[model samples]
Target: MPEWMRSFGRAEDGAVTVDWVVLTAAVVSLGMLAGVAIWGKTGGAAKGIADYIGTQGVDTTPM
Candidate 1:
């Protein structure tokens, strides 16, 4: 190989940018999953509370 070509064909030492991008993507995905789970539980809890209140004859209609 020509000396000029050899210099241009050097192997990369490390790939910090790619590693960071992958890690950030993983964290974001996990966070979104957790948020969805928590949101579902919260909605269920709210529904249960509303049902209990209704059973107790509490008037929930807005004035």
Candidate 2:
């Protein structure tokens, strides 16, 4: 009801800061979700590669 309170409510000085914080949070959340989705496949692929490498024999022939 007061003039000062009304002016404060209408102020836009901190709007950009609030927008940036929200945007940053959304980006970080999306990145974490993407990483979690890929992590399972990554681990499986890494294990398969390691198993394949472990089966190969090292040749020690001297020139």
Give per-residue CA lDDT, model 1, range 2-62, as digits (tens). 9978866784545688788999999999999999999999999999999898889657999
lDDT of 2 by residue, 35-56 (tens): 9999978999999999999999
Instruction: Write down the RMSD of all candidates, one decimal each.
Output: 5.0, 1.7
Q: Using Cα atoms with residue i matched to residue i, what is each candidate's TM-score against the true structure?
A: 0.60, 0.77
Candidate 1: count of backbone clashes, pairs at least 3 residues apart or interchain: 0
Report residue 11 deviation for candidate 2 (angstroms).
2.2
Cα lDDT of model 2 overall?
0.97
User: Among these predicted structures, which one has the highest lDDT?
Assistant: 2
